[model samples]
Target: MSTDVAIIGLGIHPFGRTPDRTGLQQCAIAVSDALKEANVAWNAVDFAFGGSTDAGNADTLVSELGLTGIPFMNVANGCATGGSALAAACNTIRSGAGKLGLVCGFDKHARGAFKVNPKEWGLGNWYGEEGFALTTQFFAMKIQRYMHDYGITEVALARVAEKAFRNGALNPNAWRKTPISIDEILTSQMVNDPLRKYMFCSPSEGAVALLVCPASDAEKYTKTPIFVASCLMRTRRFGTLEVFSPSKAIEDQKTVTQDASKVAYEEAGIGPGDIDVAQIQDTESGAEIMHMAENGLCEDGEQEHMLARGETDLNGRLPINTDGGCIANGEPIGASGLRQVHELCLQLRGTAGNRQVKASPKTGYAQVYGAPGVSGVTILNS
Candidate 1:
C-alpha cells in the first residue's frame, strides 16, 4: 500500500551540551514545542518511534508526558537513529495502522570522541584492545583516500568547514555560532590526518521531534504542510566500505548513501537536479564533500569547483545544511537526522529565517549515514 505522509510540525531544542538537563527533559521540551506547533495533543498521538544511544529506554518518555498507552518503540541505528525512527513512523501511517503519530529523538553525549564496543558491529577484540575503534580514525582514512583519488585539495576541506561555521553563526539553535575562516580551519589542531579539531563534529546534546499524519489530513493542522515524498533506509552492500570496517572494497563497490538515494529518487519520481536544497552527513568537512558525490548531487571532483564558485552557499545554486549541520549543531546521535528533517522542512516551507535559501525552493533532500554502513534518505516537498 502507498500513502503520502505530511510533516505538519517540527521542533528542535538548542543543540549543545546541556549538563543540567536529562535526556528525557530535552525530549519533553522538543515534543511539547512540536505538539504546540502542530496544535496536537499528547493523547491524540497514536504511537511514537525514537531512540537514544546514551539515554535509556525511549518509551519511558511517557512518564514525562501523559501515559496514553500508545505504542512507542525504541529504535537504535547509531547516528541514523532519528531517520530510522521517522521512516518507521511514516510506514506506520502508510500501512493504515494510524493517522497521527510522533517521531522523536534525543541524545546527551559525553565528552571526547564516541567510543563503542567492537563486538557490537562484529569487529574482533583487537579493535577494542588496540584502540582502533575510534570513529575519527576511520573518517580520516576514508577522506584521505577520497582526496587522493579525486585530487581534492586540503583547502577544499577547509572551505566546507568554513561554510559550516558561517551558516552556524546565523542559526540561533546551532551549538557553535562563531564563524571561522578557511585559514583558521586549516591551522586548527589536527585530530586525524587532514582533519582538524574544528573540522570534526563533537558528541553534543540535542533533541528533535516531528508530528506527522496522512497528507489528506495535513490541512487540518497546518496551512503549509511539508510532504514526505519518500523515506528510504538501507544497510551496507557486501562491497561497501564504511567506518568500523577492517577491510576495503576492491571493486564493484557502491556506498549505502548512493544506493539508498537511488531508491529515494525513484520513489519520489525526482532526480538530484530537482532538489533545491540538501542536508547530508557531515561528520567532518570531508564527509560532506564525499557525500555530495555519493548522494548524486554532483559528480566526483565537482566539489572542488562547487566550493570555489560558491555554488553550495546559501544564495548559491543549491544550499546545504542551511541551519548549521552536524558540523555546527554537533551530532546528537538519535537527534541528528531529525534535525536535518527539521531544517529542510523549514526551507521547503520558506520559514528558514536568517539562513533561508533564495528562489523559494519547493523541494529539499536529507541524507544521514551512520556506522557499520547504514544510510537513510528522505525527500521533502512543499
Candidate 2:
C-alpha cells in the first residue's frame, strides 16, 4: 500500500429522491460530515475537488462550506467523476503540495437522466433515432454476445441482480431496500433483449465525501484510518469497445477498465487474488458480470459457476458490491464512483453494518466505468 496518503474521514448522503433538498445542499452536508469524522474544521482543508453531472456547479459549495479560499476544481468526467476527483487529491498530497484535502461528489438526476445525444459525438442523428444510442441496448448486445461465445446463461444475469438487491436490503443508505428474487428479475420488463428492467440502475440522487491526509498524521484523525494503495484512471484504447463508440477497430484490444485494473494491481504491489472484496461498475446486471472478469477478479466464463455456487454473496469467497452498487444504489453520476470508494472504506474498517463481509477483509478493490470509455480503479488496505 501507499505510505503517502490515507483516507481519514467519510460521509455520505443517502441515495434516491429527496424532493425537499437541492443537490448542492446535499453536497454541503456530506462535506460537513467528513470534516467531523476527520476531527478538522473546514478551513483546515488545504484543497478541494468535486462535481456533478446535472447538479449545480461544485465551486459554489464554498459559500456553504466556508470561504476557505482553497483551490477547488470542478471535475466533469462522465461516470468517473468521483474516482477522478480522488486521484487528483491523492496526487496533490503525494506531491507534497498539500497536507490535507477533500474529495466530494454529488448529483441529482431526473427519473430518466442518462439520455444520449448521438450528434454530439458525431455519430449522426440516425444513431439516436434508430435506437442504436440507448445505453441499455448496448449492454444487452455485449452480454448476449458473451453468452453465445463463453456459455454465460440468461440465468447468470438474473443472479447478478438478485445478489445486488439482497445486499442492498442490508444497506441503510441504499435506495432499494427490499430484496428481489431471481425469478422476479428474470420476468421483469425487458428493457433490452436479455436485460430486464430490474437489472439496470436508475438515475437517482446522492452525495459522497472523503477526507485525505498524509499517512504520517493518520493516527491523529482516527484509529481506523484506511490507507490509499493506488488510484488510477484511464481512457479507452483505439480498438476497445467503449460507451458511445460507433464502431471498434479491426484489431480488438483490452477494455479501459481491464487496462486500468491491471496497472492498479501492479502499482499497489498486489494481484487480483489478494483482493478480499470489491465494488465494481454495475450500470446494468451484465456490466457487473463483465466487470468481474475485466477487473481480473475472475476468469472469463467463470462467473457462471461462481454465481451458481453463491460464491459472490456477502459471505462468499469474494463479496462484490457490498453496498448494492449502481444496480441497487442507483447511479448518481458524479457520486456513484465515490460511493464505491466509500463502501470499500467501511468494508476495510469492519464498519459496513449488516452488509459487512463475514471474513475480516484486509484489502478492498473498487472500479468504475463511464461514458466515452473512461475507467478508474482504486485499491485500499486496512
lDDT of 2 by residue, 22-89 (tens): 88999899999999998999999999899898998888999998998899999988899999999999
Which residue ranges in model 2 land beyond 4 Å of their true spot?
A: none
Question: What's model 1's overall lDDT?
Answer: 0.92
> lDDT tens string, model 1, 96-149?
898998899999989899978899989999988888898999889989999999
**Global fold similarity of model 2 (TM-score):** 0.98
Give the 10-residue window scoring lowest on summed lDDT in candidate 2: 113-122
Query: What is the lDDT of every predicted structure here?
Result: 0.92, 0.91
Clash count for candidate 1 is 0
